[model samples]
Target: MEITVHSSKSVKPDYGDSSNGDAAFASADVVPLSVFDKVNYDEYIFYVYAFHPPSPPTTVLVPALAKTLAEYREWAGRFGVDGSGNPAIVLSDAGARFIEATAATEFAGSVKLLTTGDKVLSLYPICDGAEELLLVQATRFRCGSLVLGFTMHHKVADGPGMWNFMVAWGQVTRGVAIDPVPVHDRTSLFARQRQDSPAQVKFEHRGAEFKPRAGGEIPGVSCGNVAVHADGEEVVVHRVHFTREWITELKSRASSNRGGAWSCTTLQCVAAHLWRSVTEARGLGAREATRIRVAVNGRARMKNPPVPEGYTGSVVLWAWPATTARELLRRPLRYAVELISREVARTDDAYFWSFVDFASSGAVERERLVPTADAAEVPPCTNVDVDCLLAIPFAKLDFGCGPPFFFRPGYSPAPVAGAIYVLKSFEGDGGVDAYVPLFSRTMDAFKKSCYSLTPPMADARL
Candidate 1:
């Protein structure tokens, strides 16, 4: 677990576009934050990729990263405040922080365990404050295996965008052309329409997303049966793997009782399964509400001038679905799936526009509000949020030898509960992996409940 840091430095873009022969943002420019980008102003996303021997060394990887950053200019920039005092990225070629380190032990057999513990935190470069929008660490093990770690502020890009950037870096390392050039103009993709009036606000942002629902007394918000976690409770991440057959069965069961017209999607069915299981494991009161915050991407939902596939930035919102514990347990799996599907369907183009308009309305500042999606702001115990990374092209992220044998969220020492990250299985068998963070006390119950399709039977056993 010991690591020795050999060198640390800021890496600027090494080259410019071949066509134009000019570096992007050659002169410093400030890119204003869109409504979506402002959601995670203080949060960062961490990624750890384990690469075995015969991979590109730091000598080549670092330059490839610099080249990749040249194309994705925002990653090489630093955060700053715009003229309006709104969060923005200063494209001043501030350079991303890169560190080269060495680990004494071999990394072949211990990728999973090494990443699960707090020691994994050493793999990532320091990203605190406004030091760097993007930071990377290359840790070479005794056996020549490399553990590449990346940390990017969520304000700079969402999960999909960051993944795309990672893929681009891999493409650069392999000397391949970067496919699907990224579009970084946040104003065009997410800003409120220029024709619309500034005062036009469609949704009640305070009630729906930000502020508490007029609860002068109740400690929990009913949005998704949100309740406070016990103070000093230990939260641990428990991973549950679903094979293709198990997923198929879950989907079949979730789709069984529903009308012929309403078959559940993969995400809906699996999320429902997890939601029900987690709720059952918690053993909440009959009247206690439980809800799951489903993360929905706004890219495909936008209309008119549609958001490009490669558009980069945060354009994600949560779909909150709630039901009482008794009702959830009493209902069939299909019922829970229907609830999830219905709520996800509600987050259409209109909903995204409403959020964009609401962000610019000055109401957020006036009300002193923050989005519940921010993990720091989320109510710890009763809340369950799901982030799906099923579509990310993990296999395409081949630097030289092959794609990463394993990839996962970097370990955080903080106690976070009820967040499930649905990822594509490393086996590439069309299966799924759910990394569930829960109170350590309920992990055993969750492990048993997650595999049971019949909630009644599962609850009885628990």
Candidate 2:
């Protein structure tokens, strides 16, 4: 496949002093601060796939690519913002290369984009291997020859906001005008803090010190942030689908256990199930201990009324629950659900705020505040290493087109055995998509666990 590059048609905004009665800094026009800014992290990555029924003629693919770019430009014009909060229409060099390189390759292979300082640029091809992650590749066996893949930063927008941007781009590409432009009003949900608050959450960045103790053997698999060395050799991803009815039942069970706390219960139950499955796969008894962390978005749960949906500020809170994997599996599912529910509920209480304040004040050492394995004792013998589940709502994201066919969050290798569960609406049914990154050696075990869920087959490149 061949790829080409082009200069972005967008322009940069000037930061000169203003005259007239207008305030020098207008809140409405300024780039809204995102919650990502407060969190120390790298970029957020996402992938999009566009499939054609059969290998469209080269004629169709080329023009379609061009139209897509034009549409992207228009969408960027309306929704894109610069660091200074101006009508920034330009794509970073990386963004430009992302679009161009995909086109040149005829949508084959992955494009790696990196952010350095304030600039985003595309790094050249890192591998000629099979398409994994965001790399797009074409195959003769499939009728659809081209797909679009993208990796962008979470600092730019949330899932809903990103969907809105994509829908706008789609409409533009289809040569239609989008009416009733989507609002970016997130003022209530993610309001910016007047000043920087010191980090309240802490983790012992053990780096590579921790060793896997799954049945006295470690799996041989390694990703950028995680590694497994063992006696196994296959890696695959299974997408599991759950019916809306099943989800409702799960939710109902969770509510009954928690006296009506919804999201927390649903998430905790799922996490518990996953943990149990991993432990069982490794022939570990139900009583082995494990810990799983759940990310909680604090915007809506804060003492103050939530920021508006369009508010693009930082308002996320997180929780880590440490318990024996055996204990989680021994109790009724509701017990685990209730445990999660109560933990999440505590974050909204004043006590949680006090903890945050105390931690920030340096009264508590980072080690004391963060979760740590009991070094004095042998680490709990557990099959599952570690897991994190995120349950953010992304269905109402309408940019005047419709919902997306697939939405996958970026993968993190830092957490040994991490997975992201997303609720996707398909044919008006709520389906759950779990994005998991595992040690390559445990591929068979992972597949077995996913097969039990029986999710429909959709396009999963990574």
Candidate 3:
């Protein structure tokens, strides 16, 4: 399990092409953080993809990375602030950090390397600073396997945005023109420009994305981003696989009690299943209130001037669905599915604009609010937090080499919070892959009930 670093350097974008030259982004050019991006200013997302040895060499890969950055200039930019002191990305072409490393062992025997903590994390570059918006590490094994790891600040882009960037990079590596050029205009796409009073807004913005001020706490409820873990607890990021057939059956079971009126979507069914199983695993009291935070994309949901297809920025919000353990577990699966569906159904254009309006009202800065991810830490299994990334075309991320055999976070975010990231499995079996982090104490219970699609009998113990 030995890893040796061979080289590390900043790869600046190559603006050789006059069409999109570096002059477009002067040293002072900056992109202000949108309302969606501001909330994730303190967060960083990590990912790792494994490829077989016949992978492209650094000679081809590094240049492709720099060429790709020319188009994705924002990634090579550094963090800064605008005149009003709001968070912004200074497009100064500061360059992204890239490293080349070698591993002493084979990829198959590297399971221990993927266990947890600093071991697997070593594969990715450290992005806990403002100097670099994107950091990448390429680790090569003796058997010709390569592990590509990268980290990006959440404020720069969310899951969908990152996917767009990665797919473009892959296209560049293969010597193809990047299809569907990225749209960097976040202000107009996600921010509200029209003048509007906070009182005119429909939904209550306080205590949702922004933390409420004095005397605004929700009695006993915690923020959606709040997660608490036991002292010295061992958290493991485990994969829970749900085959296509399993999901189909689960959908059937969830809609069985609905009398054919409506059926739950794939995510709704899967999320409900996860929430119920995690609640049982935690062994929460029957009366204890538990909630699941589901992430909803706002790209297609926005209208007027609909969000462009390739807008690269964070535009996602959470849909919080809550119920007592007794009700969530005792009721039919459809009950939990419906609760989630209702929330997601309502989180549309109006809801997104309302949130934008709240931010535009200066309330976010006035209240000195902090996002839940920046709030008190907790275990993810304590309350399920689900983000579905199934639509990300991971299989199509070919870089002259074959598609990646595996794609996952370089390291689990278990230490910070317990969470689940659902992605498409690389097995080509149409199975769903859920990257879940749970405390060792409840891992066994979760594994036992994770695949069970049916609701337990009212009197049955999990």
Candidate 4:
């Protein structure tokens, strides 16, 4: 129930030698962060790994504890990204200024930590001029359980890339063969000078309206960039659990509604249902326009030569699906499901190529992106973001002990128009994790809304 923090331990990868002794590969002096890594890129990534029921008590020499820390230090260094203690990401006339990555680890204690499977999130990555690219926190609980969490700057790597590195680290912890090594070839995403790609050329002409921010661009946040806030307004995170059985029921309902003409994936089905429910809860007019913004991973979708499987840095973009609330709610859930699918399908190799060109335009990109995340008030149109947790692979991260009991993304404080995060369910249960954050009034009504009591929801909020 109580937690106390101590001094932080800075894990500076020996820049001279990436591997202090034994490492995955030889390190480089600096790994250039790709343009994608800078878009709306949150300075810090908050992730938690739950390893409960502590490895049965074992007798170990005092030196073993220190040795484990030393080993972890070396293991953690492998991800410091070319051994930079921190990330240098401020843009300046001098070809973009960057700072070192202070990726350090922390120690804490709790009496009731890991007693329950509730997912708690906090942004631990420091953002002030004094920043740490990555900060690992180890919390010891009275129950002898542990939750290994870390916050890393998005400048280093995005979710998918970060998790892949975690998986490889787990393999090393177990002394097993690691899978695809982490690749730092950011040039794969760099824009071309030839302007030969058709999609890239087309993207250059699209009006600014189609971009992220009206006049701003992506990820060019200020030194003290913070979540947009409102006067006396608040945002809260809620873990809305969807059971496997319920997802099946929704799919079945969707199939039935389609007269067995078509079927949708669990995500599409759930996304459709929530899209309608959230719209209704907001008390919006039936004919009000609503849209869903989804983050798309372009790693495998790249054309010709795709980004390597274990490529480092961010490889993501957004896909939008919009329709009037009346249209969305009036039609069967299948309609929205199809719409979401169609918009998502639009993201491919060509789309990514187009994105690089769009972002490379510089100031226009910044003009279009900042307003979306920084505007004092949201536009009249209702836009909700849906985050797919599968991309992060939280459940599969095992550090020689076992898979996590629970995992969740860091808390998001975006001004509460609304956002939905879909993640794998807790250990067992065979369900899904939907971390939804909305305006207070909307959530209050949502909990008691008919949607929560319906068959698809299984009448539970776990």
Question: 1-462, model 2: which lDDT tens digit per residue?
Answer: 333443222222212321112132222333443333223123344444434434344334334333433322222222356676533323321122223233433322322221101001122222223121122222221223344445444444544444445444445435455322444433323332646643343432221112223233233444332333344333233345556677666556545645554454445656655655554444444444555555555545556444444332334444555566456545555666666666666656343344344434543344333222211122233423322333333333322223333333333322234343444433356555454444455546656764343321222210
For model 3, the stretches where C-alpha displacement exceeds 4 angstroms are 21-28, 111-119, 128-130, 191-200, 213-230, 379-382, 410-413, 457-462
Give the range where candidate 4 is weakest over 10 consecutive residues by summed lDDT.
Answer: 91-100
- Candidate number with greatest lDDT: 3
Best by TM-score: 3
Score every model by TM-score.
0.88, 0.54, 0.89, 0.74
The residue pairs in collision within model 1 are none
RMSD of each: 4.7, 11.1, 4.4, 7.9
Better of 2 and 3 by TM-score: 3
Candidate 1 vs candidate 2: the TM-score winner is: 1
For candidate 4, the TM-score is 0.74
- Ranking, TM-score, top scorer first: 3, 1, 4, 2
Question: What TM-score should be assigned to candidate 3?
Answer: 0.89
- What lDDT is obtained when candidate 3 is compared to the true structure? 0.76
lDDT of 4 by residue, 1-462 (tens): 334454454443323312223242233334445657655455455676656654322222112222322322322332223334333332111111111121122213321232122223321334346344545655544554555566665656767777766676566555455456556556544657354554353543232224344443223122111223334444555667788887888788777755677888878887787787777667666656788877778876886556777675788777778998777766777778889999888877777776676666665545555413232334442767787875455545666467776565664223234666777776467777676666656777666652452432212211
Which stretches of model 1 miss by more than 4 angstroms?
Answer: 15-25, 192-201, 212-230, 259-261, 378-380, 411-415, 457-462
